[model samples]
Target: MWTTLFLSYSPIPEYEYVENSIPTFVAIGGFPFIAFHYPSPPMGSDVVSQSMWPLFYLNEFFWLIIGTILTKLLPQKIKNYSQIRLFCIVMTLIISLSGLGYLVLRFD
Candidate 1:
């Protein structure tokens, strides 16, 4: 599952901390560090960490619904402009909000 996510997110830039060193993928209690050479990350890991799960869930939920309806209900030749627009808008908002949540949680 996470591998799919990583592949899907391949367009993102490769940061040295996330790339070179052993990135802590999941942390139980303390702040989870992604950068290299870090055991327990600084305080406040839960802030962005928690937000990401919900955003990912929401995005999946919306995408599943949209994708299912498009595949099942739509005709082969016709395109649903409204649904496509809606999906795109929601996805963009989801990405933007998640990024914002990450910054706020990680830094502030």
Candidate 2:
């Protein structure tokens, strides 16, 4: 989605200082599952912005609502399909593991 794309490419002012210094993975989905380094504020800078923190939780709630509505709207037949379930499980694992791998390699 647009949010993931924007977060990946756009320069968020709060993150500007540590952008290139850290590795970030914005998972592919309607809601971003972010895995990234949390950099401390630069030395001697006392202003630690908490603005982005609330947005992360807000985004999760928004997507939860959307997902609930979608599940209700979707037909049971489609939801019950083995292929769909398998695909979802596989994709989730792949994305989650990829993010984990990136973090591990980054720290190592």
Give per-model TM-scores: 0.30, 0.41
Model 1 scores worst on lDDT over the 10 consecutive residues at 29-38
Residue-level lDDT tens digits of model 1 in 9-87? 3222236346556545323211121221112345444444454565556555665676798889767674788898899
Q: Over the stretch 1-108, how does candidate 2's per-residue lDDT look in tens digits?
A: 234423553233544446566424222222354423333323212322354445546656776688799999977765458888899899878876775454334334
Q: Go through the candidates in order and give the clash count of each.
A: 0, 0
Highest-TM-score candidate: 2
Q: Each prediction's Cα lDDT score?
A: 0.46, 0.48
The true-versus-predicted C-alpha distance at residue 77 of model 1, in Å, is 7.4
Error of model 2, residue 63, in angstroms: 1.0
